[model samples]
Target chain A: MSFTRPDGRGNEDKRPLHIIYERLDRVDGSARFGFGDTKALASVSGPIEVRLAAEQPSKATFDVTVRPLSSLPGTESKALATSLRGLLSPSLILSRNPRTLLQLVVQSLTPSPIESYPPSLAAACINASSLALLNAGSIPMTGVVCAAGVALFRSTTEEDIPALVLDPSESESREAVGCGCFAFLFRTEIAGSQPLPTNDTPGARLVWTNWHVKDGTSDDGELARAQALGLAGAETIWRAIKQSVPQMDNLPPPPLPSRSTAGELGIITQSDEVSDQDMNDAKIEI
Target chain B: MALQTQTGTSTDLNAQIFQRLHPRAYLERFIKEDIRPDGREATEWRDLSVHVGSISTANGSALVRLGDTTVICGVKAEIAEPDLERPKEGFLVPNIDLPALCGPRFKPGPPSEEAQVLSDRLASTITAAGVLPLSALCIHPERAVWVLYVDATCINYDGNVFDAALIAMVAALKNTTLPTATFNEETGRTMCSRKLRKPLPLECLPVSYTFGVFDGTTVLADPAAFEEPLLDTSISIVLDEGGALLSAGQLGIADKDTMSMCVSAAKERLETYGREIYAFLE
Candidate 1:
């Protein structure tokens, strides 16, 4: 059989990402994030009075609800709510708005026909909700946290070794026996350090994860590799998110870093030293 | 605590009641004495009884009681156009109802997660078993065919509801009689004659056996969900009379030996109670 992804993208490549920041005026904050054909829009409304039944005693209550692309909500949607709520609870600097409620709604626009059975739209949901929460600007976060989706791919060769794919398209995700979603925080770096998302930032945290593979299958090695790739992909998206926000034109640029570590790390920023090769790497990686 | 009216979670309120009511610890103690609390061997099945053709309105109906669990399955057959993709085949739809009457845990609303899972499992098992040849229900090529709707309701919740549902479904299908249908070319409709009933083509018997691993090593046959819902491992296996595996569902990592033991026991049940389970159909 011919070795070709259904979307004709490389196994290691992520789908084209498009982010529409502050897309809705009515909501406190809103955004639309799309990875290939799967699109999700999220809106945040909160710092409002908490209902007695749903109140939190100490911290602001974070509620995440996912409405699927088609059909009424089912067990899968309920499960997604649980996972999203868990992730947002720790990420959302809720201590600032104690005795309040933060409601986030993520609406998936398309169902995955590519991964036909028991489809999941987790990656899209997380990204859109994160963007909306940031746009809301109601709560101060310690760091910018984002999520990335990764899948394990096997080659067509006689010896099929698993390869990791970041932000896999629906069809590419279909080929993966196992996949996971990873969330990480991008913390501010030292003036001349590695990059904005160096591997060991004090605040760089993994806030959420959901990973699974076929039962009784020996895919532990594959899962570990996929998780590592997922973290890298999350960093790439974190950089892209920072770049997407309208930059500070008035503030003086930080003194050109004594060393060009950002250029070598494939990050595109206000720094004028970004090389074409670095730009290409940034484009393809994110 | 009252055995019949006593509901779940209310047990939490009645702590002293649970001490006397639940024999789980007592059962474990009995195992040390080389006996089950119910006075049976580890592999011994609970007493089961089946009554077929009990519902007057349904074409086929059966009520099954295993130990304390009770399930009633009713199969209704109607003439309908066959699907375009499988014109020669009919259809079978299985739905399981977990109503509040069965227990306090189930609420009155849409189908619960447990119900949906059981419905899908029973449907897949029926399809894998080839319980009825779709071609046998065809009338006038693709114009009309018999569609069987098998619905099971849990009236009592003692335990092993899946086993009771599967047995009731098989019994109900066996009791079902196909009505005579003649296709008319003029109206493109089927005319049915209920009096001229005929038996459906049932070639093989598909049965399920459930086993639960208690305390990791001790395995109990037909374990009750009420007493021990969480276990180290729980497996349900469905097999046909031909010794071919039909369908299987497992919750946890069951040891290799435990799986094989359950399979061997299920095969034996296919010959013993599996065949005797249909005695009421005649």
Candidate 2:
């Protein structure tokens, strides 16, 4: 039950995906992401002293969890957690903060036989974790953006697949067997570098691509199509992550400094509603 | 807020905070002038801007800004067994939270009374408005139902938090367009499909209007924190689109006459404020 494509995309192609980042004041760092059909929410806490016996010395410990959206964990989540641990642990710069723990919990939202797999969800989870770390004032990789899944769906009964499908729903995933995930990192970069100078470039174009399946079916046409869809997914995730990240940065300024009077913190009650003028007029000391 | 909690809930503490913050006299004057010092007529309201699909993670979400106030509302819906009592309906739970970081008064802990009160009010309003078509959420009546969690957060509190929160919440609900869920009669398993059905079953649009009473005589529409002082009482009116009132209440010291004044003030504001916001939403 495999779908074949000449160049993964035909005409009017799109990569379906959703990304969300919410602050969990309960945890040090947290974010939730849904790529194409796969969804995950990740929380990162600590840089504090490592607490577990399995903690690594001279470095920080990285913990990963993949909680599926629809069902309990199986082979998929474990594989995702293992793969994510490998990809993210090295990027943590753990030596900078030794004997600490960096926990990452990835909660996958979409669960089914056909939807985006855990691999792509893990990549997005890592990206979200990185962003959460940045929100927590922890500097990880240069920057982060979510990743999405792109699949080439062709009915087994027919030779020609439908138009290039972006992010397919669970039903779409079930119809197609050939699917993969793309990881995108969003960092604005100058067009030209010393080694890859942009002599042909006029203005700057911030490239947006991070990771994709390194090896698979070797058909040239199918490979091109998959790459193109991956690029499109990268662009889509970049736009969404870009929009969400700004709000995280635009936090309101800390509340006005307050002073305690009568050597005690005043108990505020319903009757304690103070006028704006009083908030300004009252003379108190912290 | 923490300060208030630290002090006992004795009438003295309540009186002190109320005296310092919400003075009855100030609100009375604003009501009397039929205008707020901020240059708004008694019926005028602050401008509003709403942006939807702002939060990527949530299934449906929106960010609404009214004057200096900002509220973020997100919807996360999940499938679960239906309640034994009401098997034919889905759930739409609305929760409002004000982070301590938003203001000095907000405390860090469980939701405050203000948050709980606002959530309950919004939840009831939404239910009455028929924002969620219960049948759409019903899966075989007593079998399964979709539980929607609507979380509204006040990131910034300028004034009239309730009005702003309501706007954001309804806007977010309006902005949300969900895909259809196909229930296979044979397998009995539900699958989400891209073929979107109709928008969430919405019956009517309801928004809340707040009136601040200062000086025991003045009726101030949408009072800011500064004018909150010298306020004698406050009123919040919930109305439908046809200029009909659904629910109205006063939140402080106000006589029956003052209450009538507050209602009239709220009605007038709804005529203008309602149209502008409703236009943005529709």
Candidate 3:
């Protein structure tokens, strides 16, 4: 008997993909992407004058904002922003545009039910934000980046045979003893002068990796297997994004907001408690 | 940071020697004598100074200085509607601000990750401390309640802002005197007494002690700012005046000795917090 995943897909199968590009007109870039029930929207704006306090003299600043579908934004959102900033900052050549602020806003339109697979939401967010940044075109990039989530789950039929499931849902992640989120970037396309290490290896350069293993389960040989499996999953995602481009529609010009720019800020739509003062750089330090 | 830990000598020209000896060697030598770099014993703490009722404009305020680290706390009490879910319970909002004046790493914009973490920790700590019971804060149950917005600002950043913030907040809360509220039966509204005469009821005080571990085992209590980033592991333990462990934050897997040493250090310093606050109020 064969073991099937919660979503009824094969161990190596990806969820049905849906990516909407440049959803907004005026913003430099915007994208809405989903992997099954989990969905997120991302928008990129600027290379513009940053607020007085956050301005840097030699390099551009990255202001990453993440919004959830419900409840107040707290440490979790801040953590997401921090993680996303760390992941994306490396892929971007920020020195090109000095003394400017690039705002990256991500909104989780639907919450994934799989609590154990928290990285899946981040994977989707990372892909959506990267897609939006690409669409915006204003922000300089060194390489094309995409991320995928993978986990090891026990089969219902044999219990002992754990399957390495790609694009694991929250339910599948909870059942899996080990899980990982991996991101990749095409090396030849990015930066200058650092030649691809070798001809066979020019395939995919690892950009980011975050892995986890459930407690009580020892790490005998599963970590290496998870890493290889995650890298393969990331390669698959990178291929899909590359192939989808030829079939994708050309991005239309961004539309301008009818009202004042401040009224349309990402901050206003974030949470109920935030006021106009919050939009005008009210200190988060407090 | 790497230079301070070298024990074996002299080949590297850039290596920093502590008193002509390696830093790790200095630490090991001091440990035998039970002393530390700053001239204090392993369990000894730096000097602490507290000044209450310093900000006249605020309902209550205090400034706390723990060694070189400084924090000023202000409490503003105002009447506000109670939450629908828990109409009888009042609200308490504690925010910790880190301005540029505090350090070079922090900017003047929205709260950084450190500030947010500190703010959330202090808020929960204050609630857990049970310093102001919700029932007493309610002027009229389900109608209006006194909301205390406690804000702590770090003016100088040396080390251990969390402990200093909580201490300043405690001092400020003790110094606070609320105006007596009377229910006007005719108007069916609560009226505030012109003179601030009533004091909020006290519950329990929670004090936190932070320690840093070198390599992975040696526990150094009350680490200075420069020593924090270099630590392999660190732990902060919070205990109430009753000696119950309320909460703790730790990085990396801590050793058994580290936990025991931190708890004993916390217990030893618990009384000093109360004694100093009592002396200040008097």
TM-score, every prediction: 0.53, 0.44, 0.51
In angstroms and one decimal each, the interface RMSD of every candidate reads 10.9, 29.7, 12.1
Q: DockQ for each of the predicted structures, in order?
A: 0.06, 0.01, 0.04
The CAPRI-style docking tier of model 1 reads incorrect
Task: Report the Cα lDDT for residue A169, model 3.
Answer: 81
Ranking according to TM-score, highest score first: 1, 3, 2
Cα lDDT over the full model 1:
0.67
Give the higher-TM-score candidate: 1 or 2: 1
Q: Fraction of true inter-chain Cα contacts (below 8 Å) kept per model? A: 0.00, 0.00, 0.03
Cα lDDT of model 3 by residue, B160-185, tens digit: 88888998887788888899886665
- For this target, which candidate reaches the highest DockQ against the unseen true structure? 1
Query: Candidate 3: misplaced stretches above 4 Å?
Result: A1-72, A75-286, B1-35, B183-189, B271-282
Candidate 1 structure quality by residue, lDDT tens digits, B210-248: 887777688888887544564455667676655555544
Q: For candidate 3, what is the lDDT? A: 0.68
Cα lDDT for residue B267, candidate 1? 75
What candidate 2 keeps of the native contacts, as a fraction, is 0.00
Give Cα distance to truth, residue A49, candidate 1, Å.
14
